[model samples]
Target: MVAAVTGLGLGLAALGPGLAPGFVLSYDMVFVPDPAFTRMTFGLTGVVPRHVPSDAFVTALAAVIPADVVQKLVLLAVFVMACTSAASLVPSRRLLPRLATGVCYAWNPFVAERLLLGQWALLLGYAALPWVVAAAPRAHEPGGTRRLARALLPAAIGGFAALTVSALTAVTVALATRGERRPRVVRVVVTAGVLSLPWLVPGLLRPAGVPGDGTAVGLFAARADTPFGTLGSLLALGGVWNGETVPRSYGAPVTATIWLLVVVVALAAYWRWGQERRGAVIAAMVGFVVASLGAVSPGGLEAVIDLWPGFAVLRDGQQYVAPLAVVVAVGLGLAADRAAEARWPGVAAAAMAVPVFLLPTLAWGAAGDLRAVQYPDDWARARHIIDGDPAQGDVLVLPWASYRSYSWNHGRRVLDPLPRYLHRRVIVDDAVTVDGTTVAPEDPRAVRLAPAARTGAPPAVTLRDEGVRYVVVDAEPGTIRPSGAATAVLRGADLVVYRIDGAAEATGDQVPVAPVAAAWAVASLFVFWSFVAPRTTLSIPLLGSIKPRDPHRRRTP
Candidate 1:
């Protein structure tokens, strides 16, 4: 009964329509204006502004889906995740691994964020992770070739699909699932490589950005130069990154506790379970440790340098905690089953692990008064203010929007002062310094102004001079304060609307007011579906139910 309920709940949460209440007020509220989502959405939808360089892959994907279809896709992704998470609860082996997996699966802000918040493709990749780890040596028998081929084929197909959707999670699976079988591993690798041919071919052929090939590393270095205390909260590098220039750090207190429990469990396994099961324990431990480091580097100097080459490719170090949680769970589960004598040892160890896992989540909640609902009213108002005059091409980008401090709030065509692919006109280009040293658009790649000027002053007087019709300042306090000149021009109002004289009749520069309407349409559809045509009665075939590919599992030993 528990298994059935959990499976149903997982299906509802991840696959949608039938099991449990879906993620209510998370990413759906916060993501529309996120920089990453917006950028991807714009490109994917082929909504490129005039003259911006866009990748063909991005454009083609978006062009195929209408706004309504995208909403359904989002819902479908949530359903799939819910189902997977629910199903995760059914495989109870022992307390320590179960608790760890349960906690990691249920919480872990990054996974929650992706699953409930935004980036549906990332969610899809995460859902496929269980299949990746569960792969095993083929059952030996007459006609084994057919059985193995059938079993391996779907797993390979699923994994390849996961990689294409979310390469980060795919990479995580690849690294964690290695060494089970050399020949099996080789086959998995070959299949994944072939499947990834599309993305690889394009990446290899793409032209280089300015400031050379190591741009990502250079950017990491610049950010790492700040004091540890500041970067600690901002980047969470305490776990993953280690560089000669940047001080080495460890996980947050919560993560530390979790790791401590993991170590204890592994040690217990080694002492009690004999040396044969040791390989699995050790492999799991290694994966969990490395995964944790990516979140917040365990070591300092060496790890940071190692990350620069290709490891930094996983930018959010915290993401590792998710898979690490899974590894720890599965490892400890095996350990709990294999333990020789004491039930209390496993129980006690698990008890210790729970508090550690909860601390980080509690700390995050304690940081501020977090309101459950993020009102989209503010964004709507901002969009309305900008769209009030469609003929005015002079919309100023907020500093936060340009710098990626938040999600996609501004439209793709707005003239943001920050550097983005939007390609709209800007008064202060991300490349130009307060004192006029160039970064990307110009050669020097350095900003030479005083830090205060860099933070406060406008990039140039170009916006006012360039016939900007309207200036926008995000109402987020303290970050993007208006300069004295900007205040004078605003006549002491909190938000000042300016009319750039003699600007050519601006076209295609306004923020559309359709977001609220679009959101409402989606809400209405869901409501109708919920009340009138409830999906509870609807039945969709499960992949497992439709076919049992692993029929020879009984003979695998």
Candidate 2:
């Protein structure tokens, strides 16, 4: 039954034939190879430490699977997991209710908008939320020794599932727990913190003192910036900051319908299961309040960003809706079960189709815009040229922009692809700031090169000083004019490569490996093993005799 539902969910998600091999969704999800780029480095550890288990996981996967295939697989995995995780949380004996829950969570406007916006990391984190919730230690549970381990397990798992969500999950657990179990919540929080050292330690060691802005507050808010939209879009679980990404087909009418249905069902669930489900009700309310506050948060989200260390990373407050989505999915499932019991099975089944009918535009590669295309042959040739060089000094990429408007990439917004494509270290000036706060690429070399790259002029002497050997200019017409110092080595339809004169002799500080990085790596491995060890023991032959305790077992009074 689980397998069938999982398969159905996957089919529904991949509604379009275009969502196949070589079909990339969005640019943010593009996997690039960088052996030196750890989660710490990628998160700008020197600026702020953030635990990014997903980065580590993806980087590790890229090592084994072909990078492009890895990209497709990651998207597929997210969709499948989103469905299955939500399904698992339904707590209903009826398969239809579970299936309904899965579809509702998986096919909603929130998933579609985030997928289109290329916030795969956020989605990945969102996908893991249900599982984290499932693993959470329940209130008033006994068996202290075993319960402590159970609590720790979810925290460790959440640590890998995006730090922002992990922190929120911890808070939710804390709020839900009371009495003796409250102490267990502390253990979970601490365990999660300790395991998150890979990103956390770096963030703590080098905090980015970036200030918050009111503009960011409004931009990342949960209210969909559309006409006559209230909490309707937020209830439908959309409210993406970039309103342009919201499908035009999902206009006010559809939004209103979804909101009404959600309210009716939620009211039914509350009336039917009131006080018994108080914890869940409170969680949903808290989640909605927090999500609704994007940027202009009265709860001091902007103040928190400025005052709190490692808080700036969570500028998008709408992401708080993720937990609310889980609550809604579970509520719908419970409501469906109740309807089935009351001889309204047909009505319950019809409710299952609500997300599909309302979010029709979200199916099949987000209205056919997410299909992947193969990289140009010139990219491969350029890779070959860069790989052949023994010195492997930094290569500079031009049309100097952080986010590239790649015509070949279906004109979707994407990070600069050069760094990922090149074999050698390539310097592409793509420093980004949130509001007025500088996030990264604030390196002196990148700062110096940004202007020259924009002008199509090579700061040749500065490049030499920075140990930059080769310059690869994307042959975009009217974007890059050949610098006087650049001697074109390879010119193709797509790219032009230049060997910088006297670059081989030029030297500078090699990219330093932080000592804490190695420690974090070791700690991350241990945490990962801890999460998986018990499961492995149960499944494997020799260790099968261990008889792992049921994680869901409830303590009696």
Candidate 3:
């Protein structure tokens, strides 16, 4: 029954509107920003974007569906993930102690808010994490080889699954969680090696690691310097801390209460179960904090440069939260499970666990509502402009308002977060440092700055003299409004598109030539084997011995 539900979750999610069971958001891989993965997948299947780690996967998947259709399907998948993760508590009903476990998963803000519409593979991979951890040996046994294999078999499979969503997360979690159980050192290493094989094999054959001209690394490395000790860390954990500066968004009175409920429940569970599961809880918390801080860590720049110089890696601090969210959710689930197993009635314990699952749904729904007000017209208007230009070539977008939204409206290519190898697009989205030092909207220090683009900077008559072909502004008039040498071509309430008469056109696109046929075929085979048929052998028993425990399973208070 439990297995059935698990399989059902996976199957149902996959069968949903998009046929892809991942997070749903307006961020499209193609069209809007730069053609990166979006174009490679939609335009020519023969060519793949070099920089984005998941280009092949997203492209192959997107090829089956039109880009516009994929966006809507992705939206449905996002909702399904939310509903399924939140409702995954049913099968554990008899195992009341473990009932709260599902709530820890379903109610998690990170799981609901971000995973619902953002990174799909991570969501699927994360769903498998708790089961894998719970199945791990608490101590070494004589059936050492078998036990070790048992543990790593699942870990490898789960890690590989995560790699498809975000390779870095897969690597981090695989490395961090290694040797946590009985330290069959050899087995641990082997497991990690195998788990990483899917990606490593393809990566080795590829000429470079992640694609891009390597300029993005400057922005990626700047995220490590955020100050450690501060109350502000909580909000920032979800990239939502800037209430005063960025304006409070993704919050609602009802959803806020649910978020509060989960926090309170987590605290309660922590207090209740601290005596026994403290180490696991602490480790999970550390991962969560580190990943969150790493995203905005300014201090990380020099460290990343020192450690991984030349490679435009580690630009995504938020990416760390992917697996960390799983660890923390698992920890919370375990904590909640332990608390429920105590003297409290199963009903009462379940009551406590219920909110953690619901908070995510409400919080995200609220966030969507909030974002609706902030960027409502932007999507439609952006779509209209992109549609107006029917050319198949790349189109530049300013102020970057949800690439997926624009892609849906206009089939044109864009240079979003992920850079394309085929349609090499110049992107200006830099990272925000820990101290909040980012390339300002109109900083003159940048070689690419133009006067109209620099209105956010000091009033410089010199800036207008610089050549800037297009200007997209979401701000109000007189704030950063265009003036000399630029004419407003299209204007919505807040969004305005301007054209520069004499500015030179930006350099042409730089698309990556496809890998050699043999290499591409081999890479595809490895991905298939790694993700599809990862498990070659199954334990003879197929199920573990049911070690019944005392209802009160702890020695500590």
Candidate 4:
């Protein structure tokens, strides 16, 4: 429990301002006030289901609690679970080593970078890696499927990205510890596949056939975040592709060099004291290789995507470094044990503090980049307007851009949240421009409408053809061409809404919710049964084993 407290402390430090009641909006981390379910929430769209179950999961929680609170709770749970879970794997029985492991895992550069990038959903998987690793060998045991499913619950909520990472960790551990061709591997695969149906089915069923944009591989592949280059940055667990997401002052030669040295020392410690755990050693090697593959993506990646679109998940290879985090955390704890054994308890304590010291900027909510803020009143007004309308036509968000630096969000760049906040389908730009190269979007609507939204005029006629009845213009206003004097009669523009002549009912492909719902039901049964089921025996050392009393014997006192 000391380790758990330490973990909570690290979380409180990292989330200082973010612990406030408002939504902490930045990059991909978007939380609406009161999210409601929609077809889009179920990944029922023309594109791959990236947020599939994660959005749906959050919406369910929001039905009981405010979404912002749910966001904070989930974020806090990430740290608490990460810290405690990492500590659980240390070979040493000493408290110092456990504390060291908890701190090292909870406050590293990877967590900082991913948090700053606002991929909280991905972090949910990252945080749960230790638990998945612990559950790997036991997966071969009886009832292991249920146990594995419970360990994977957080990743299940995180959808595709998280589940993929967890799969790598679980399968690698199972293979390394227990030889392949075993039932454990089959059980692991089946469990992951069942939970994955929510997103998997939609991606397969997507009219675009999994929505692959080949250029994304080159655009999102890992890059150097330190003077030591891509390999060094990756070794130190900080090679996220987006340079802006690196923590403040982290790339300085001195700091980056210190971090690299720290990684080297941790690896040495693992080699000396913890390497015999074949699972950790093999998982680390596998993770590093996968990450390096993305850093130096071969020409075949795009071709591979041509053959199979799901392979596109490999584009963001840096996320695969998650397993390496587990190896390093346990290694650092082992190093602490060695230090204390050498009669240098202070050094052991110093090891516990080293991660936070090296990544100092993670404190106070990534140095205030993660502060909470209120959405504009106009946004609420717009939602109310959209929800009040009985007429059915898709809501199109304008500006032909994705991220916005809104004054209300303290000038932070966030993916437009209108689609998640509103009750009906709302389309926003999906194309992302990085380094003067625009990665094409996977959304069919974006492909079909972007051109007309950019260059077409006579707003009503342009939208009427596509069945768009209302348009939302946020921050970047006036992107839409005003209706000419001749066409003004059919167009109306208010605060953020552009009303036009309604067209035919919104027409497009949508994923069937039945399969995904049934998948969740199946996974939930395993998860629930994992907690409640037993052959029925409770034993205490001082007493004989006891069987569960039948309700018919309820009068027993």
Number of colliding residue pairs in each model: 33, 5, 36, 0
Better of 2 and 3 by lDDT: 2
Model 2 scores worst on lDDT over the 10 consecutive residues at 537-546
**Model 4 lDDT tens row, 1-557:** 88778888888999989998799988998889999988888788665688878998899998998888899988888898899889988877789989888888989989999999889889888887888888876665655656787888889889899999998888888878844336566566766877787888888877777666665777788889889889888889989989889898888888788877877888888888875466867888888888777557646677777787778888887888888888888888888899899898997888888898888999999999899887777778778777887877787776778898887788888988888888877777888899898978778877778876665343566666677767777755544543532122122232357666555575566767687677667666756666787542212221122122244665746
Give the per-residue lDDT digits (tens) of candidate 3, residues 1-557: 33334334533333243233222332222322222344333212112222233444444455676444454443334334333443342223434434344444444444443333344444444554433333232322333333333433322333333433333332233334434442433333443444444344434333333232223333432121123222223322343222211112334445545544555555565446444334333434444554444344545544654555323334333333444444334334545455445655655465545543344233433233212111235534654554454333232334432232332323222224323422322233332222344432211112244332334432223333333344555435234544555566667664565554444443322223343334345434533443455443323131123222344778586
Task: Please give the TM-score that candidate 4 achieves against the real structure.
Answer: 0.92
Error of 4 at 249 (Å): 0.2
Q: lDDT by residue for model 1 over 426-494, one digit each (tens)?
A: 333234221232223221111222232245444434444444454455434345543534432342222
The TM-score leader among the candidates is 4
**Every model's TM-score:** 0.48, 0.82, 0.51, 0.92
User: Against the unseen true structure, what C-alpha lDDT does each candidate score?
Assistant: 0.34, 0.61, 0.38, 0.79
Which 10-residue window of candidate 1 scores lowest in summed lDDT?
44-53
- How many clashes show up in model 1? 33
Which portions of model 1 miss their true places by more than 4 Å? 1-30, 33-100, 108-128, 135-259, 266-318, 336-370, 373-378, 385-395, 400-470, 475-557
Residue-pair clashes, model 3: 36
Best by lDDT: 4
Q: Model 3, stretches more than 4 Å misplaced?
A: 1-69, 72-99, 112-289, 292-301, 306-328, 331-343, 346-364, 367-394, 398-436, 440-511, 516-521, 531-557
Q: Hey, what RMSD does candidate 1 come out at?
A: 12.3
